[model samples]
Target chain A: MWEQIRSNQTRTLVLVVAMGLLLLLVGYFLGEAIFGSGIGGLVVAILIWVVMNLFAYFQGDSMILAISRARKISPDDHPRLYNVVEEMKIASGLPKIPDIYIIDDPSPNAFAVGRDPSRASVAITSGLLERLNRDELQGVMAHEISHIKNRDVLLMTFCSVLLGTIVILAWFGSRMMLFGGARGGRRSSGGGGGYATLIIVAVAILLMILAPIAAQLIYYAISRKREYLADASGALYTRYPEGLASALEKIAGSTQELKTANQAFAPMYIINPFRSKGRAASDLTSTHPPISERVRILRSMAGGASLAAYEKAYQEVRGSGRGVIPPSALVGETPVAARKAEAVPAEPGKVERARETSDLLWKYSNYGLVNCECGTKLRVPPKLRGSSIRCPHCGRVNPLSSRP
Target chain B: MDCPACKGVVVVVEYQRIELDYCTKCYGVWFDAGELSLLAERLDLRGAALDVNQIAALPEKKAAEKARGCPICRKKMKKVTLGSAPEVLVDVCTRGDGLWFDGGEVGQVLGQLKDKGAAADEQGRVIDFLGEVFHVRG
Candidate 1:
């Protein structure tokens, strides 16, 4: 598994280099067909892409955060969450503490964004804070921190910028073809022209049609591997895969679509924004693996299993009939291996139980109004005001007041 | 000076009262958030509510002010737009507490929310009707 992860990283690095060379080669050839292989024009386009993409990459964080209406938080405002990040940062050996931001969204999701660990930030929805308990929160935070520590954020952003450049270039090339590139072609063709113009136009069209999809595929492959890497690294940080496993369960339950998230930032989120499609279990086109597989892996890690055992278990679970579990409460001990096997030959009654438990857990985590005073937690509904309640442990009469 | 919605806490900065009633999750401003209350009291609620659908037409501009911590932001909220509709502007605490709606903006925002709720219901009904109508044809 270690060797696979290492090899994957090496492979992705090589692919990035190969992609750049391929793009340059194509650009050079196309430039020749139109401009008679003028190195100046080819060089100019490369320079422009480098300049524009660098500028976008540098400012991308602020732009994305502003669009989401996320607000920065100081450690004083959210101490527990701050502490969780601090712990993860220390464990991950990251030099600086990443800034924390919270989206005022009532959806359970979090994503890490930035060019690198030093510049990176993690944003979690208010729903995540309200839904997951301390340990689970740590699990989720650890996952994001893992992304940063592994430099996945930087790699992903670079991939996006490169992909965007390819798309823009393709679009421009297509526009030139339709509107007449022959006019421009004449200037550099040295009057040996018509055949060069036709070939250039045809090839330009071909590249334009194929580049974006190819870029997208490359981006997805990189992204999916990074997610797997992060999952593994996150487990190493928390040393309790169940924390993340349970967090995934809770998040998977809601299925409330994020209205604000668009495709550009959608891939960064823990779960897909289009959860309403009942696509939680399907990893059809997504770069990220299925949440069920992630949960299964995490659970196995939590249960103190070897990596080989986890791999075997994961493959077994995937082939079997059991689909992803919806949001369920963490009540008792459920080992990863056991869950994977149970998922394999899921009994009819157990499937019903999984659904029921998930529904219950979702409700308990979301709508329960728990107000703690003197460390005693009281869960009350909106209508239960003015009721005389006693603390379970302290024997003190705790009257419910709307003001509090 | 008193915030009308949650009535939890209020802070006075620059001789203006700022109230906090905003929930962290929903990020919806509550009535007690200062300028909103003043605006609501001065304006006609029914008229403001009727104009709710036009809330998106409001203008927003950053106001020049020195730092004075808002009870919500726990840091000074630079005077930001309070109402997006009927174009009322107010001070907002940076910390996401509550917004201070100027004059009639609060009532207008409430009115807009009501209109939105109604619009949503109307849309739902249309969809349901279409579904039923299409069901018979299919």
Candidate 2:
């Protein structure tokens, strides 16, 4: 595990440096081609890189969180969810519990963000809490915790920084060439400049066309590998492979899309929250492994959850030699205790708990809840004044009055 | 605000820009002043047009059981009967904080509204008559 973390940091550093240089080179070419001055574009490119790097290091998590409109929730606000996060923190032997957050969206999705575990925050949508039973919920939390423990969040942040910069630079370069903005340089440099402009145009086309694909290919490789490792580690942490498998099925099966999930932040989620039917295992552009493939691998794990089991299953499903769990991770790895569906928390009435999960988000946001005898939980406003209430579930009328 | 029925905390969520408070334990929903109307408006359900006006006009109800304190102001709330088919009665805070409904009540209210909308729509009424005549699928 230690070796894996070290390698992860090393790879992230290498990738960032490599991508940064690529960005500067593209900038220099485009600057000379468009502005008649390579130095000006280089300066602008460097400044952009530095600013993005600073943002990714210091405030990337906050920015991502704000974009998603995530609200921080205290333990007392949601004991069930808080407990799951606490359990994972202890299991991972982390220094402290990661901050927990809730998104008001109805989609069943979750993601973790931060530079490290101690500073990390995990957010889950309201739909998730209402849908999964305890074990499944625990499974989801464990996967997120594994990402934090494995430093994948930091890797993803770096990925965002590099990919984001390159895309922006490419877009700018392409726009300039297509829209006649490069004429400034073409006209100023005179006769010899025509040949230079031709070269510039060709280079811009190449960079605009191939640079992002190259960056994305790199991003996809790192992302998919990290996902497998995280899944293995998450199963190991929870000692329950089936839980995550089933949870993934439920998440994937749902038609509800995550309303606020950003493309830049998609790689950080447990599964891509966007609408993508193509299997990530097959698609070069996907940031996640296919849902069916992942679930199949988890279900195939014999005995207890372990890296060795996952590797074996990975080979069996995707064929041998392609799985990415580090050899260091497999060393001294032991099978975790297998959990059955019986271990699921006792919630017999959850099937009837429609939209109650969103209701819970409201409760956390300072609304009131009413429990009906028919197992229907209602989300209520704080300032409500009304008469007789009919239960939507059973049609039973419950009395409401100011005085008892 | 604390849940009036249960002691659990409640959180606010926005649906179509209307903020509604919902309890984690009970799954009940609450709407604040004018929020119900706003939600109904957003839902575009026809029956809801009659709800708010009818609710304010209905006679005060005799308490059926122990009256609960308002979750927000801790005062006694007013019991207003929702007057219409698939009728609903909800407790509203006298101080105007909001109204509370047990789980699934929102669906019933919305159902009533939709039913009314369906009834009034010419195409819907025609479809219903034809589907019923042919014993069509649910």
Candidate 3:
């Protein structure tokens, strides 16, 4: 595992550096096209990169959570979710349990974000909580925790921020060139260097257009592989591959789209947020590997829950010689037997699960709950100025302010 | 979410895990994207009466009622008729945020589901629930 982490860190560094170079190159050309000197653009690019890196390092997780409209919850809010996370934290040897958050979207999905395991947080949709059972939920949590443990969250954070910067720079450059580049080139061309200036502007425009696409390609390339690793690690953590396989199956089967997700943040989710049913498995641009393929690989891990077992299963499923896990990490790794499904006491039924999830949403939304004598629970919205609400079921008036 | 018609804060009324945002003053109801289906599924109404996709696909209706903004997106919602015999005009967010039923419209539209010959028991349960929930004194 340490070997895998170290390799991941090295690869992340290489990728970040490569993306940085791309940013600088785009900057240089834009500078030359506009200012007739590459130095100015290169300097600005470096500054942008540094500031963005700092911001992503310090505030990336919060930004993501806010964008997804995720509300933080304590153990009292949802004990089952907290327990699963706690169990995964202990199993993965994490220093501290990650903060948990829930999104109100009906689409089932989850993701992890942080600079490190200690500072990490896991967020799942309300639909995910309502749909998944104990073992399946554990499987999903383990996968997210594996992302934190493997430092994939940090890598993705940096990559997304960098990608955003490049896209913005490219957009600004293209607009500037369209409106002002010709004049700048015309002025420089009058100085006996008109042709060269025009050519540089053209090249700059082309590079500006291609830089974001190139960055996205690189970004997607790095993200897809980490998902498989997380799955393998998640299975190892829980010693159960079927749990994750079925969880993935359920998530993919849902037709609902996550309203808060955008292209930049789509890759951070467990499954591609934008993916619909029947998408081809080998889509090169997708941030996630195909759900069917991932489930197949996980289900093929029949031997046990171990890095070696996962690698064997992965190769067998893919019918390739290459292994997903690092060779060093697989060395001397013995297969650990898969655990039987735990019979959680008094497991809530589907309706109960749905109620619990909605109750949490109501709590976060500042809704006041009023239990009617006829058994219908009324949730008054916070902004409701009325002192009393008539029960929808029993037609009994329930006073709001008198509860305290 | 505020009621699209009354522009007043709406209270959420939940029964059997189906949450409906109801306004106290106007007795209007706001059904976020999937909640209607949830309500229908809970009532075991297998018909297309409450289908969001079908309702959204309904042609825009020219009405005298003033357009209202969706509480979630604040976009101007389109007026569309829901039922055939006595068309109940409702506001649907162009962005698919939700459907907004004006005061008494929920009962009027849901009550018509019985005419379509959907299972009487299921239709009766939903209509009864909606009628009891949205019952407001003039």
lDDT of 1 by residue, A1-404 (tens): 23233333456787677667656755655555545554754685587569766876788888878887777878766677799999999877778899988776545688888877788889887656656766678889988987887777777777777776776666666676567554446653566566756666667567668876777777766677677667665665676667788999988766445546766565677766655455545544576677877887666543543333344445455666432211121123232332222232532232232223222332333323333354434443343334554432244555555323
DockQ of each: 0.02, 0.03, 0.40
lDDT of 2 by residue, A1-404 (tens): 53364373455466666766777778887777777678988988878878998988899999988989888988877777899899999988878899988887656899999898789999998767767877888999999998998888988888778888888888988877778667645575666656657877678678778888788777876787788888887888888998899999989866556879888888899888876554445687888888888899888888568778888888888877765676666777665656655743566334323344554555555545555575544444555556544444455665544212
lDDT of 2 by residue, B24-114 (tens): 4576566653455334444454563334334434577785745667775687767775544545667766654556665445545544454
Q: In DockQ, how does model 1 score against the reference complex?
A: 0.02
Q: List the residue pairs that clash in candidate 1.
A: A32-A37, B3-B32, B4-B32, B5-B32, B36-B101, B39-B103, B49-B111, B52-B112, B55-B85, B73-B95
Task: Please provide, for model 3 over A1-404, each residue's C-alpha lDDT reduced to its tens digit, 9 standing for 90 to 100.
Answer: 53365464455577778887888889888888877778988887778878988988998899989999999999999999999999999999999999999999888999998898889999999989888988899999999999999888887887888888888788878887787654556677479777777778888888898899889988887798788889999999999999999999999877677879978877679999997657778777889999999999998988599988888888999999977676767767776988876677898866678778988898777778898787667777766675787775567887787432
| Candidates sorted by lDDT, best first | 3, 2, 1
Selected candidate, larger DockQ, 1 vs 3: 3
> Against the true structure, whose lDDT is highest?
3
Model 3 agreement with the true structure over B94-114: per-residue lDDT tens digits = 766678878767757556645
Ordered list by DockQ, greatest first: 3, 2, 1
Q: Show model 2 residue runs off by greater than 4 Å.
A: A2-18, A178-180, A183-189, A277-281, A334-345, A351-356, A368-404, B1-138
Best by TM-score: 3
**Best prediction by DockQ:** 3
For model 1, state the Cα shift of residue A162 in Å: 0.8
